[model samples]
Target: MTRAYLAFTETGLALAKRLAVALPGSVARCGRDGVSLAEWASAQFVHSDALIFVGAAGLAVRAIAPHCKSKTTDPAVVVVDECGRFAVPILSGHLGGANDLARAIAAVCGAVPVITTATDAHGIFAVDEWAKHQNCMVLEPERIKLVSGKLLAGQPVYYRADFPVMGTVPAGLFLADTPEKADFALTLCPTGQALHLVPRIGVLGIGCKRGTSAETLEAAFAAFCTRYGFAAQAVTAAASIDLKQNEPGLLAFCQAHGWPVRFYSAAQLRSVPGQFTPSPFVQSVTGVDNVCERAAVLDADGSLFYPKFACSGVTLALACRPFAPDWRWQNA
Candidate 1:
């Protein structure tokens, strides 16, 4: 689902087309009549996940300068030469993955990747990139530079994880016995003490009455999270039976929270293995004994963390994936 926009001049149009073939879901845009490069770049900046400009680095810099935002919000911006000799990531190198995209483009074009990031140059782990790979949200992203600076200075950066961590620990990052001793923490649970990386590992299964109000669903969701000690930000997706696919209340809640909804047919829900609360009324109406718990197990491909909880015609269940550290260090 990564949307990339390839903009190139006449001299680089051929390379752009080849690059488009390499990158799925990418559109190659040329400077056509009545469409200025600046306008095209601005539009892509707002709408796309990545913008690949196959021309001068200065041109790419100028085009994105006006639209430049913080590293967390801006899209990846990469510049390539006309002859496809070199690719350089000029903006949002780690969090937005511009550096990684530039390296991929370089590999495709048999060109060199001009990466200037200190951690990458030194073959050190980039915490933000590692967080993205693990589907975790970095709390206090503005402090990311401070963490990296300490690492580059050979300062200790201890980490404490509530979940089991696999693989060897990276340099400058040690396993802390307690959160108080750690410089950063990783957990699914919410904490206000230290900078934490929260994994989006929860799948929320919802079942609501046809006319359930958004306020009711929102309240139910909050109660579910609070009761289970789950952070709302850690829920990656929502699931339900196909009967609720068009339900306005459910759809609005998911849309507001930026969580994708997955719907399963009644038969599919019935096939999910679990000891769910069987309701004769629900089975008679929806052809399934349970929707919320079954849908959550199916979506997560894992066991449930919390069984069905119902309130005011809104039902919710949560499933979790196995906890494992997504190690990014090469040496590890």
Candidate 2:
């Protein structure tokens, strides 16, 4: 991760240099240029992984006030005084990993790290933090407060995971056998309510006509997810033949959803071993009998959840990779 160190004084600059030993790809900047701190913070928020302010806590707060967005997307922010008395995480404690970073800074600079997140303070089950640790895509991010609130209030929250749980389940979260018995879910498929965590273990394979419209392709994508009980937001990679790599319509569709398309040559698709519903017409054109089915399962070690299906001038297939969640192992 990258960090931008903004030091206000020469003493703070020296501390910034010492703190730089912890972060590899970090840049330290001084305030001698008379640049606006607000504008500086705005620019750093877009690309910086974390922002370290070596100044007063109120100064850091005022500089980042307008640039502060959601805790989910914002970069980790920490403030440390020039004397290195305390390292406090001012924003994005859990999901953005500011709390852990503050402790690391404190260890390096010999400062006290102050953590104030309710879930961490009480040692409860934080669904959002666990989801990020598991590399799962959080659906209904707005509803994260509901799960956290329930846990903080000492209320029982039931959850269902389609995959295997490898560690001891955290307190306040019960593992339910079915979705009907749960308050939230941990799966890529559709669940009952708003709180659900989708693991990024799904592979989406696509095959479409040469000149299909982006609108048609997008509509087909939404419908495909709805009809097959899958969440469109859970797709990690979009696979297709090499010929469609430059296809304008396909590129636009994936780009709109922030999904990168993975292109495989016809030979690569053909080399994939498994049962496939071959199409002679497709083979004559692209040198592969099955593009969608072959592309989906080739990179994933799991089976194809859906066979080749055609709709809206676009052919699609869905496949899943094996996912295992361990409560003890966190990316933090």
Name the top TM-score candidate. Answer: 2
| lDDT of residue 216 for candidate 1 | 89
State the lDDT at 92 in candidate 1. 83
Q: What pairs collide in candidate 1? A: none
Across 1-332, the per-residue lDDT of candidate 1 in tens digits comes to: 26565556666877887887887546565556566678888888888888888888887888889999788889988888989999899988887888888888888989898999999998886788787777788877876777788899989887788777776788888887776876677777755556678888889999998988788899999998788776787888999999999999899999888999999999999999879988888898899999999999999998898899998898999888766775763212
For all candidates in order, the CA lDDT equals 0.83, 0.84
Clashing pairs in 2: none
Q: Could you estimate the TM-score for every candidate?
A: 0.88, 0.91
Estimate the overall C-alpha local distance difference test score of candidate 1.
0.83
How far in Å is the alpha carbon of 310 misplaced in model 1? Answer: 3.3
- Per-residue lDDT of candidate 2, residues 1-332 (tens digit): 68888888889988898888766445455556665677678888888988999989999999889888887788999999989989999988877879878888998989998878888788777788788778787778788889889988888888888788887888888877667877778787866774888888778899999988789998888888878888876788789999998899999888887877899999999998889989999999999999999999986657788888789778999888777788852344
- Superposing every Cα of model 2 onto the true structure, what RMSD results? 2.1
Window of ten residues with lowest summed lDDT in model 2: 23-32
For all predictions, the C-alpha RMSD in Å is 2.8, 2.1
